[model samples]
Target: MHTQRISGQAGQTGRRWGALAAAAALVLGAAACSGGSDGKSAGGKVELTYRIWDSTQQPAMQKIVDAFEATHPSVKVKIQLTANQEYWTKLQADATSGSAPDVFWMNGPNAQLYESNGMLLPLSDKLAANGVNLADYPSSLVSLYQHKGKQYGIPKDFDTVGLWYNKKLFDAAGVKYPDDTWTWQTVQEAARKLTDASKKQYGILAPAFGQENYYNTIFQAGGSVISADGTSSGYDQPAATAGLKFWTDLIKDGSSPSLKSMTDTFPSQFFESGKVAMYYGGSWNSSTFAKNSALKDDVDVAVLPQGTKRAVVIHGLANVAYAKTKHPDEAAALVAFLGSKQAAEIGAKESGVIPAFNNTQQAWVDATPGFHLQAFLDELPYAMPYPTSKNTSVWQTQEPITFAPAWEGKSDVGAVAQKMADLMNTALSKEK
Candidate 1:
C-alpha cells in the first residue's frame, strides 16, 4: 500500500497529497465546479457515481452495478475509473468541496484521514440494519476501515503478495522452480544462477517498494513497520535490517536491477517482458498476467520465500460513501449491495480479485487456470495486515526519499534504516 510504484507516477510528486498551494488551488477549482447533488437522473431514478482506481476491474464493477440495478431498478450506478496515483489527490479535492463521488473506493492508507475528517459516512448502523455480518470479511480488512470503533467502509476485495517466477528461465538455468519450501537462501541461490548478465536479465525484480517487495520480507524476518499499538516505528530493529538486506543484497550482487533501472521500468513490467526471471508481485496482477500474451504461459506464482518465518502483507479495498451525499439512503444501499455475497461473487468471477466475502474466493481462482491462485489464500494464516496509521501517507511518502541511498547502494542498510525509524517516529508523533 506504499503508494503503489506500478505506474511510477506516484514517486514523481514526492508527496501523495500535493503541496499546500496546489491543494488550495484544487479546492478552489472543485468548489467553483461543484453542484449540489441531485442524486436522481432526468428519469427520476436514483443515480449514484462510484469511483475506483483499477481500470482492469472496471468491466467487472460495471457488471456488479448492472446486477444491483436489476434488483432496485430505481437505482443507477455510474462507474468512474481514476488512475491510482491521482486517486487520493482528486478525492481530497472533491471531499474539501463537498462534491466527492457518492460512493468511492477507499484503501487502508487514506481511510483514517477521511474518516477522522468526517468526510466518510460511517456504515456501521446501516450494516446492522441490513443484517450484514462483518465476520463475512477478513477481520483485518474490517478493522482497516474502522475509525474510533465505527466502520466507514465495506471491504470489496483483498490481495496478498507472492513470488512469481518464469518457468523457462528456471529451466534454462537448471534451477528448481520456487515452491512453498523455498527460503531466502533458496531464492538467492536460484537468483544467482538465473541471472544472465550478457542478456541484461536478472533473476528477480526487487524494486524498493513496500507492498510488493520489502514489507513482506520484513514481516517474514520477524520485523514490523510499526508497533502493534501504532505509536512507534520498527525500522531500526535488527530483524528489520535483515529483511531490508534481502533485497539490497540482491541489488549488491547484481541479481536484480538497480533502483535506477527499476525507477525507469516497474518490476511487474520487467517480469512480464521476461527481463527478470522472478518478481514479488501481488494477487492483483493475476488478471494482467493472464491477459499478457508474453507471460500468460510461462509465468506462475508461489508462496513467498521465507526468511525467519513466512509472512505476506494482506490489504484490501473498501467501498465508502461520501458523508455529504444527498442520497444517503441510496448510497448506503449501494454500498451494502456491493459488499454482499452476490456482489462479491460477481467481482471474483470477473475481476479475479479475492472477494472479501468468505467462501467466495474460489471463483477468482477458477477464473484463471494453470496458475497457482491458491498460493495467495494459503498465505492468510501468517499474513500481516498492511501497516497503517492515522496519517499513513505522511510517513509512507517518505520511504523512497529516506531510503534511496540504501536502495541505491550508496549507504549502509542499518544506517539508512535508523534514519527511517527516526523520521517515521516523528511523523507518528504528530498523529492523534
Candidate 2:
C-alpha cells in the first residue's frame, strides 16, 4: 500500500472539490467546443486521459500508451501526472463530482473505499471477454483489487520491504553484513557494534513509519496489526508489544537517532548521508539508491531479520477505470492493455517496479545488478498483504498520534500499545 497521507481537513475538502469543479468546467468547455463524448475529438480521433502518480514510471507508461496508439490509430491516450500526496484527494474530489479521469492508479488503502462507493468500474467481465486471465498476475495482487466478488482494478506493479545496509559502515565497524540467517538478536548485536557517538553516526534508523519500519517487524514477531476477521486490533498482544518495543529499545539504547532527530531528517536521508549504517526500506528504493552518486557502490539489501516468523508486507498499485466515464469501452481497453504482459515488460525494462505479470519480474532483477533485487521477489511466499479494512485510512491516520509517546520515550511500549489497540478497535468496529 502507498503510505503518503491524503488531506484530512474539512476545509481542505471544500478547496479540493472547488479545484475539481474548476478542472471539470475546463474539460466541459473544451468538450463543448469539440462536440463529442464517445472518445472522439472534432478531428475524428478517440482521446482518453490516463492519470498516474509516479513520475518515475511515466516513461514506461508513455511507451505502453504509444504502443497502444500504434495498434489502434483511432484512439489517442493523454498522460496526466499527479504527485502521489495529492493524487488521491484530487481523484476523490473528481469522483464526488462525476469527473474522474477515464483511467487512474489505485492502491490497497483506497481500493475498497472507491469500489464500495461505486466509483470504480469492475473489470472481470471485460478481462474475460478479452481472453485475459486474472491468473496471469500474482494471486495476492489480484485479490487486493477484488471487493466482494468483483475485480475492480488490474495489478500494475508491486513492492516489498527489506533490510538495506551500508557495506562501508559495516566494514568500518567490523560487523558482518546482514543476510538471510540474520534475526532480531543478530541485528541488535550489530546495531550495538556499529554505533559511534564520537562520529555522530548511528547503527540504524528506525522511524515511526509503519510500512517501512514496524509493520514488517510486527509480522516477523508473529504479531498482527489487525485480527484475521478484521474485527479487532492486535496491538495489545505480547507479540505485538515485543515487535513495537524492539525499535523503542533501540532508540533508548542509542543504537538509533532520537525520534525527534529522525522526524527532522528522515531515516532514508540519514542513511544516504552516511549517518546511519542500516535502514529498513522498501524495494522501490533500489532504483533511487542506484542513481545516488554518494551511495553508488556502498549499499546492498538483505532479507529482513526474522523473529518468531519471517514476513514482509506486500503491496502494489493497480489501474482502475472510473465508473462514470463517458467512454467505458475505451477506458477498459486502456486498463487491460496497461496490465498486459507487454506493458509489464516495458515497466520492468524501465526499472520502474517489479512487474505483476507472471514470469516477467526477472528483467527488474537484472536492471539493477549491483543490489540483490531478487530478495524482494523471493519474499513473496512469506509476505502478508498490507493490513487493511474497508476504512483503513480511518485508523491508519491515528497510528502516529497514538504511538507517538512510545517512539518519544515518554511512555512504556505496552501502555502505548494498549492505547493504540483501544483506538484501533473502536475504529475497526465501525468499518462494517
Candidate 3:
C-alpha cells in the first residue's frame, strides 16, 4: 500500500493499520495458498493478475508492465487496484480460498507475517538467477523483506521522513530557513519565533504519530523501538524518554498545538491551511503538497532536526509473488522486471515516488522543483528502518491507546512511555 500515501489522509498513519489487526487472524488462519487461474488468452497470451492498492501509482505500474510485455509478448500482466482499507481484507479472503493474485504489493508491517505464514514465494535464488542485484536498492529496504535468511520480496519504492515548512510563514516571522545544520535547539528557537497565538499559528505539528513524528526522534536520540533481536521493547530505556520529551516539551511551551486541536482536525490540515509554520512529514507528501494550490508555491522540505544525532524513518513497498502460483516461471519473470532498474526509472519519471533502485531517486527530486526534495535523499545514510516484528499490527494498534494520555497532557511522558514498553513487551512475547 506504500503506507497509504496517495490519499488525502496521508498524514494519519493511524487509519492505515487498525483494520490490519482484524485481517491478521484471517491471514494466519488461511490454508496454504494458490493463485487464481488466469491462463492463456485467445492469442496464446499468458495473463497474470498483479494486485496493488495505490491508484496514483497505477499509471506508472502500467508503463512498467507495458515495458515487460514489450519483451515478453506471450505473457501479459494485469494490475488490480484495491483501496488500502480493503486491500488486506480481500487479500486475506483470497489467500484463504487459495486464489490470491500471482503478484502483489507488500509493506514492512505485513511482510514478516506473510513470509512466516508461507504465503509468499521466497525469491533469493530466483533473483540471483535472473541477475538481479540486491546492491541496487538501499540495504535497509532490502533487509525489510527478509525473514529467517530468505528474501520474500523486492523493494519497489522507498520513502523517508523530512522536516517540511512553509516558506511564507518563515519569511513572515523573520526567521532563517531551516537547513542541514538545524538541530533540536534550532527547531525550538525557530518554532518559538514562528508561533503567534493571536494568529493561531504554530511552529510545527508534534502529532501522536509513529513514522511521521516520534519514531525518527527516538532513533535520533539513540533509542530504538524494538530490541535488536526483535524479542523485547526499547521504549523503557532512558534515551526513549528523552526522545519523547522533545515533543511533550514543545506542547508545554505552547509552540505546538494541543493534541486535542490536532485530534479534532488532522495535523496535515493545520499545516496545509497555513495555520502551522512547520511539519514533519514523509517524502510521499511531495505529490500531495504539489497538488495543493495554497502550498504549492510556498512549501519546502529539509532534513529532520537532529537530536543526539541525525536520523529519519525509511519505509517502502515491495513486490512479491504467491507461493503456489500456477505459472511460477511467468510470475518470477514479472517480479524480476518489476524490480529492475528500467522499471524503477519508469516509475521515477512518472510515479511521483522515490524508486528503491539506487541512483534513481534524482528524478523524483527533480519532479518537484518547488520543494527541496533532496532533503529526503540526503538522510538515506542515517535512515532507520521502520520498526516491525512478526504480527506488528498487534502492537501497532496499541500504541495510540497506550500513549494518548501523554499526548493529551494528562499523564507524565516518562510514566506513559514505561507503560507502553510493558504493553509492547507483552505483545512481542506472544509473536510466534
Candidate 4:
C-alpha cells in the first residue's frame, strides 16, 4: 500500500514509522512484565544481565526487568538488546567465551542449538519447583523447547498468522471485507480482482522465510514441515510440494508482487498505506497496526483463510537461562517471575501480542476495540511449531535459492520444491 505523505518522514516513499512507538504504547505496557510476580527472591544482592533484540520491545523488557528487580531487591536485572540477528550472533560469541547473559530470549530455530550445546540450563526442574505448569502453554511451543524428554525453557506466549487487509482498497474494488470464513480460493479470487499492476498494488507479500512465510500454508495443505522425527525435509513430501505450489502459482500469475519488490519495499509502512491489500503474517503486527493513525480504523485483520485444511502455525518464544551463569538461583527466580500471570499480562498489554499464559491473553484482545484479536487466540489450539534442529538453519540459508523460482515465476513450483528437498538432504548428510 502507498501512503500520501503530508511531509516529514525518511525512506524511499516518505512512509513514517514514527507512529509505531506510540502504537506500542496504546495498549498494555508494564503490566505485561510485572503481573508475573509478587514474590521476593532469595537474598544474594546479585546483578545479572538479560538480553533480547528489538528496541521496540525494550521499554516493555525494561519494565519487566524493573519488576524483577523490585520483587527481588537482592537481584538486580541489567538488560542488553540488539537486532534479532545480532543478538543471536553476540550470544553465540558470549557462549564461546563462557560469558553469556543470565537470561535471554530463545526461539524455535536456535532453541535446540543452545540447549544441545549446553549453552542453556534446562528449566524443567526449576519450573516444577516454582509450581509453573507446562500445561498452561500451547503444546507446540512447550514442545519446541523440549528435546529428548527434557525441557530447557519456559513457553512465553504464542502468535499465529493472519490476513491483514486494506479496507480502503476493498472499498474501491467493491469487494466485501474478508472474515473468518474466507478460504484460500476466495482470497486468490479477490487478489486477481483487486490487483492492478498499473498502480503498483499487488495481492500479497509472500516472503521467502519457509517457516515464517510458507510453513503455515504448507501444513495447511495437509503437510508437515518436517518428518515426525525432525530428521528429514518435508518439502519433497507431496502435501508440502502441493502447498508450495499454491502461493507460487499466485506469483506466477502476477497476483502477488515479485520477491524482489518485497525486499525493496518498506513493509511496515506499506501494509498501512494500502500499497499491499493483504499481508500473510502473524498477530505480532497488532501493536504496529494499532499505532498508524493514517490507517488504524481503515485497516483490520482476519483469520488466515484455510488451505486444503484449516490450521495455523503457533509461533512463540521461550525465556531460557544461560548454563554458565554465576547467578543460577537468581536466574531461576527471574524465570519464575516472568512465567507468572502478571508478567504474561504485561507482555500482552504492553506488547499487544497474545500473552503466552492462559487468561492473560484475553485481557489483551479485550483491550482492542474492533480487532477481536481473539482470532489468533482461537488459532492457538491449531498452531504448529518447529525448533531449528541441528541442520534446519543450514537449509534455511539455502531455502530462498531453492524456492526462488516458485516466487520468481520462472519454474515449476513443485519441481523447485523437490529440488529444495534434495538440497536439504544434501545438507543433512553433511551434519552426520
Candidate 5:
C-alpha cells in the first residue's frame, strides 16, 4: 500500500482523496478502537488478519505487523499468505460471501467491480483522521481504486514492462548492448541476427494471450483496447491489426519461435534458459530470473521499443478492507499501517519488488546491478493503464481463447480481431 507503477484511470480528485482516505483509516482505528472494545483486557487482543498472494512477502509484511503492534499494544495481526491465481479466486469467494480478511491485496483489473459494488470502504476520511498525506504514494495508481469519487484501497507495489534480453545470446551473436531508442524493426532485426536455428533458439518470444505482456504493444500501435467511453471494445482499429501482425508475422517470417514451441513453454522457462533472444515482460520477473545462474551477468533490461506511441503498462497491487468486516476499526488500522511508507520500505527491501511509495522504490532498483530499472521508472509518466473495467475478470479469463484463433492460424487476423472487439463489447455491455 504505497505505490509503484500504478495502472487504471486516476480520477480527477483521486489523489486528493487518496491522501485523506489512507490517513482516515488510521485515525478512525486508533480513536474508535482504543479503550472502546474488548481489546483492552489482559486475555483479549484485537486480531486483524491480512491476506496476500506472495509467500515471499510474508516476512516483510510480518515486519510491518511487528511495527504496528509495537505502536498499538492491544492489537495483534495475523498474516495469511496465498500464492498467485488462487489468491484472486479465493479472495473473490470470501469477499462475495462477506467473510473476507481484515485487509487483503486488490488488483487494478478488479478494483472497479469491487469499489462499484460497495464491497470496499471509502478510506479518505479515515486517512485524513490519521493525518497522513496521500502525496507520499504514487498518485497515478491511487486513482485506480477510486470509483465514482471514493478511495477504496492503497497501492502496494506497481510494475512496468521492459525488454529483457538473454545476455549470453547477445554476446554469442556479438551484438552490441540494446539502447533506449530501439524499435520493433530493430528488435526484429536483432532477433534475426541472434537466432541460431540449429541450436533451436530464436530472436524473441512469440506474443501470448495475456494483456500483461502484449496489451502495451496493442496500445503503442495507436490502437485501443476499449472504447473512449469505457463502455465497449476498441480493438477493431488498424493499429490493433498491425500490433497483432507485428508478432504473428514474426512467427510467420521465422523471426520468433514457433507458436507451437512457445505454447509448450512460456518466456519464463525459455527466455531465461537463453533459448530466446528477448522478451517483453514486467520487472517482477527479477527474482525468477536471478535463479538462472547460467544467464548470470548475461541478462540486461531495456526500455520497450516504441511503436506509433511510447506507451507502457503500469500495474499495482493494493490493500482493501472488506466493507462488511465486524472489526471495522481494527481492519482499517491494519489497512492504514500497510499503506504507510514504513510498510512500503519493508516490502521493497525484503520482498525485492519495486516499491509503490515514491520515496522507497529506489532501494529496490539498487538491489541488483546491470538491470536497466531506471528505464522502467522513466517510462512511468507516459505509461497507460491496462484496459481494465468493471468485469475485468471476464476479460482476463476469456482472452486466451479469444486470441487463440490467430495464434493457431485457424482464423484470419481481421475476422478474429473484429470478433474479439464485438465479444469484448458484449461483455462490457453485460456489466452495464
Candidate 6:
C-alpha cells in the first residue's frame, strides 16, 4: 500500500512519481548542512527527524518512536507528518537543500530512485551489527528496498489485496458469499446476477488499477508486468492479455460500472456508499470500512477468486534512513528498532497495517474482529511482490493512459495491451 503518488487512506500506492534529476549533486551539496556529528549539544543529546506521510498511522509510529526513545535515553526523535500529495515533493526539495529528514518512509515506486542515487543509507551492515535479522520480515518486502544487492530500507508493514463484499447485496441477489473456493467464473456469475441496471448497482468495482485489479490477475494468469531481469515488458503475453481483459469484460458486460463512472467517483466510495456490491481493495481498507458506521456491519472480505491460479499483489512501506544524516548512528538505531518485533507488535495492535514481521500478522487480524481480516494474511504465501524496476514510475504513469480506451469499451484489450507492452519496453530501455 505504499507508493509515491497520492496515497489514499488505505496507504495504497499512487502512480505519479517524477524521475529524479541531479541526484548526485543534491547528495554532495547536502553534506555540509547535514550538521555532522559535531552538532550534538553539550549534553550529548541527539535529535533525529523521522518523517511519514500517512497521518492515520502517525499515532502508532509515534508510539514506536517513544519506545525507541525510552531505550536510547539520549536520543529525541521528532515525528514529521506530511500529506501524501506533498510528501515526495517536500522530501525531494529537502534533499536538494540539505535539510531532509534523518529517516522517512520509502515505497516500491521510489525506492530504487533514492537508493541507486546514494540518497539512502545502506542498512545491511548496520542491521547485521545491531543483531537485526532480515529473515524476521517478509522476503518480498526485504527485497523491495534492495538496490544493486544492498538493502537501503528496513521492511515496516505489508498489505495484500482482497475481495470485499456487501452481505446485503449478496442477500438481495440470492448469491452465495465468496470464499477460497471461488474462482474467476464464480465471480463473473455472481457479478452478472448482482448487477441491477435499473438500481444503478454494479456487482463489483473494477477500476483500471494495478495492485488492486490487474496485477493480481496478471500473476494468476501466469503473466508478469516486467521480466525477471527487469529488461522487458510482459504486457503482450497471452496471459497478460487475458488478465487485462478481466476488467474490460466486466465493463463491457455491464456488471461493473463504466471506467468513467468509477473514475469520477473512486471505487471505494462506490462500494462504501452501496453503489457496488463488491470491491477489490487492499488489506488497509479493513480499518477504513470498520470506521464507516453505515457499511461496517454488512461488509466482509474474502480471498481474491482464482484465475489460472490464486494470487494477490503485495506491497509495503519501509523505514529508510537518509545517507546524509548527521546522526547516522542514531538514525540507524531508530530504523533498526522500528523493524523489531516490539515495534511491529505495537503497530499491529494499534495501526490498521499488517506488520511485515513474521508471526505478528495474527495480532492485526485479531485487532479487527468480525470482518474476516485474515483473508489478506492467508494470501501471503502466494502473493507476488508489487512489480518494480530501477524506475518503476516511468512505466506506471503510462498504464492508465495506454489502457483507457479498452477500459472505456472503445478498444480491444489485447490490442491495447500490445501497445502498452511497446511503451513499457521503451521506458525500460531508457533506464540506467
Per-candidate clash tally: 0, 0, 0, 18, 20, 0
Q: After superposition, how far is residue 304 of candidate 1 from its true place, in Å?
A: 0.8
Best of the two (3, 6) by lDDT: 3
Candidate 5 lDDT tens digits, 285-401: 665676667775778888888888888877677888877666777777778878888888888778767777887888788876667677778888777766677776565555556
List model 2 lDDT by residue over 152-184, tens digit each.
999888877789999999998889889999999
lDDT of 6 by residue, 89-181 (tens): 788778767778889888887787777667788887898777689999878778888888898988888888899999999999999999999
Sorting all predicted structures by lDDT, with the top scorer first, yields: 3, 6, 1, 2, 5, 4
In candidate 6, which residue pairs clash?
A: none
Name the TM-score of candidate 3: 0.95
**Prediction 6 global C-alpha lDDT:** 0.82
Give each model a TM-score: 0.89, 0.89, 0.95, 0.85, 0.86, 0.93
The candidate that wins on TM-score is 3
For residues 1-432, write the lDDT of model 3, one tens digit per residue.
Answer: 234332113632212432455555667665455565567877789888899877778889999999999989899888998877778888888987888999998888888888888888889889877768899999989999999999888889888888889999999999989999999999999999999999988988887788887788899999998987789988999888888888888888999999889878877778899878889888877777888997889889999989999888888888999887888778888888999999999999998888999998888888878788998999999988888998787887777777788877899989989998999999888885
Worst ten-residue run, lDDT, model 2? 9-18
Q: Is candidate 2 or candidate 6 better by lDDT?
A: 6
> Best-fitting candidate, measured by lDDT?
3
- Model 3 scores what on Cα lDDT? 0.83
- In candidate 6, which residue ranges exceed 4 Å CA deviation? 1-38
Q: Per-residue lDDT for 123-161 in model 1, tens only?
A: 888987765899998887788888888999998888888
Q: Evaluate model 4: give its TM-score.
A: 0.85
What RMSD value applies to candidate 2? 5.5
Alpha-carbon runs more than 4 Å astray in model 3: 1-18, 22-25
